[model samples]
Target: MSGDLHTEWARLFAASLKDSGVGHAVISPGSRSTPLALALARVLPATVLHDERVAAFFALGQGRASGRPSVVLATSGTAPGHWLPAAMEAREAGIPLLLVSADRPWEVQEAQASQTVDQIRLFGAHARAFFDLGLPDAHPAALAAVPRIAAQAVLATRWPLAGAVHINARFRKPLEPLPTDRGEPWRPKLAAIAKAGAPRLFPPKPAPDPAAVAHLVEAVRANPRGVMVAGPLPALDAPAMRKAVARFVRASGYTLLAEATSQLRFGLEAVRPIGAFDALLRAPDLRAALRPDLAIEIGAPAVSAQWLAWISGAEAPRRIVLPGERPADPAGGAAAMLLGPIAALLEAAAVDLEAAPPGADTASAASCYAASWQAAEAAAWAAREAAAGPQDGPLHEHHVAPMLRSILQHGGTLMVGNSNPIRDLDHDVPPDAAPLEILHQRGAAGIDGLVSGTAGARTVLDGPLVLLTGDVALLHDAGGLAAAAAVGGPLAIVAVHNDGGRIFERLPLGRDAALADDCEMLFVASHGRAFDGLAATFGLGYARVETEEALRDAVAAALAGDRPVLIEARVVAGGSATRAALLAAMAKAAVAAVSAAK
Candidate 1:
């Protein structure tokens, strides 16, 4: 075999990717991946990162933000292992990602060759599809097939469901672009095949079954008291889908319970979604009064424990789920599953509602039911505001969350970190705020890659990007700060330094007084370091703010600037206790307000 075979094959594969609409590539520096790296760089906008894990998550962010797959290139051995977490997230979250691992040739299999492991199916079930492209060959047929295989791999990432796809490429020595002993016999044929170009493929959007739509419409007519639960919907970020969802909610008259990451929560007051469901449901009376006869869920499962428990209870409503690619019924209690595009299904339901007549007095009852939810939602937000006291008093997640609205008033992306940050943002941020694009790693709900993911999202975002993260989550992906800087976009990171894992403090383990010392030592894992020094290390501007005004200024400045900035908001120790107390107060106030309204 000629040494130029691998380089030629790599060039053809990279060209195929470009033809298939892959615009960005994240390459982790390694020797085995040199050919592909050079080829991809020539055809696409490429970002090189030192850590494989950071590269993978960065690519994951791009996929999530752009709704397109970003190719991730890594060398053989454990280097590919670092991508497992991001790959799992991509699969679970339905984000398109293409993972290409460069491997040693067949002769070194199980022979203890350095950086050589069984590269076949490295990502396992986490990937939507896996292909082992055998070693580069000069054979006419083999050379001609490289472009087709590359096109197929890219298409697989989006087809059945948008998820990760793997391509294992084996290479011989002379991975560089240097000429070898063999002449360029196959070059002309390869160029001819490349000139033909692969077809541009798009994922098929299955229309909602007509029968299923009619059944659901009939159910809506019978069930006056219905709830539309909107969960984490990253796919609904597109304007067309968001508008479709709004139309369905306004036409159906079902009380909408929208999660923070649902993309339907912040705007669309004309639809009147119940954004305070988390706090309002905490009151038993409100929960009982708001129970519905039917529940329709879209997107992924919700993040609220109270909402989950309430929906899955023994007296729970009969559930209908519109699961896009995979079944999202976590409680395994869905009465009917409608598999189709969410936007299409919603639009169909809205159109069908005009034809279906409601049962006698059903319309009046539904109106009354929706009115009650709106009243409760208003009470919940008012009660929360009353209990939060003066925003200038102390720094907490509650204060930090409301500040986000002002930062993105003109419109931008808000990336919320997992654990307490997401919960706080969900609970406190008002539904009437300016329209913004919000993203979170709710697929796995882990706090591993917050920084890198934010950085990745920045690459594709048109406006400023802000990340709300805890100290522990920021520290977990500290290396990602380098990647963020390298990407060179406007990014502001608000690090809530409340010592450590304050999220654990809200769990049962955190409240065990008998094991107070152990709980603090093990569960919270308190770290006393500040983020200013870390910011300096990464050449990012830093600020430490203790008051609300200072935080507002810091965030505004960061967003206005062209470089990345890290703002540390020091939360008072035991901020979790403060938050818990606030929730309790809000719950009590909400019940009284509801009772008075009744």
Candidate 2:
């Protein structure tokens, strides 16, 4: 007759998740979630991470790359609690993450017993959809709804938009189905179940509405001098949406400034992207000159302090944010929003904008305006070049970004660890460098999961994988290396060994004398501990490179070998003092150069 309902429930859950197109399952170690965990691990290609927070973010990264929901599994109690930050990020970033957590059963939790707490709605607003799947049963309705519940969870995570969905699986144990418990019916029944497992689509993407297209085109026509800003875009399930974004930007006769995380930064032969806009916007004169009649931001707000300030200062009448999954103003400055799927909107607008006659003076003016911004961007970079002082000291912390761009092969991913590494990328990554795919935890922008997340991405990405992080960030999530070592992927970390939280040195908090007393020990927490021992502990290849050439060589050699490697580039991090001074000089020079421009 029927086996453990918990086993059947979990098997059905995994079946429907796989059926609904979830590509990967990232499970954490826990006793309560044993049945579901084992079922999902066996059914789907699974990765087991020790930390729930790291596992969730790693699942988040996998979602980013694959454009599909990755299941993050955890046991009852504080384990599910750790997934909140990543869940919040998934919601805001528009990445679909399905959280499969085993929760305490009602009877156990009712007594307020050990390892039992109320797990209902634990993630608060962070989860886009929440389901408390009651304790598994062999009842008719429940058994029938098992696959459908799994399929519905898939729909909920990605439905009208994309984000995190929480499935709190409450299990009454006899968690695993003992092979002997099945009696004599096992063999033939298993053969029949295997015959029925097939992939499915719970809900596909929406179609383009003609009315929505008209409104988008009309909005663009009204603003002839619009500039396109591409920020963090959602992980698109449709591949066509990917190409459509670039084509739309290119055909719009508008200048495009894309953030590194935006994914639109690459495949830009059809369009010359403004990678230097963050630095260029630093020159007040250039930012003012490029001020448009309308600012059409295609994605979310970028990670550029200069751009954020400049765009925020522009009059509200000039701001037009493309409709997000949610209706709120991400930029806090959107005057209006154009409604529709971004793919459909961009595809429709591309055709309409291209067809609009040259007789339409607005179209011609838009082209000239785009070209003018391009020329002005070149001038700003020229000023930055002129402002550069000779670096006779050790390889500057900023140089690692440009150097790694060459080492990672085409179609490779470079996930930037948070703090100075990402900011440096935003400020000075060479414009001529080949556009490698870049990923960032720009959601919460935390340093907690970089190691684990990088390890997660290597599961899906076939090319050379690298993590560009600093000293402190590495130490913050050092425990995550256990997962990395176990995953057995040849990973490379271009670690900038700046001992302390040196990122603060550039801000007023570091420069201000009032805060100098605690600046060293409290704010920065400088530690001169060695890294080789840490590498050995984690079974990672360790190389300390003193010169830029040696750093490059070490990174290449490490990537070529079979083990996970840590290539440490020694840099004196005085709170980014050197970077701050260099950028200031460049902005000053850029101001002088653009002073004559209209």
Q: Each prediction's Cα lDDT score?
A: 0.84, 0.73
The predictions' CA RMSDs to the true structure, in order, are 1.6, 3.2
lDDT of 2 by residue, 83-173 (tens): 8878887887677899988987787877867778778888888888888888876555555566667777887788776789999888776
Q: For candidate 1, write residues 288-315 as lDDT tens digits.
A: 8888888898888889878888877886
All candidates: TM-score: 0.97, 0.90
Model 1: number of backbone collisions: 0
TM-score of 2: 0.90
Residue 25 lDDT, candidate 1, scale 0-100: 96
Show the colliding residue pairs in model 1. Answer: none
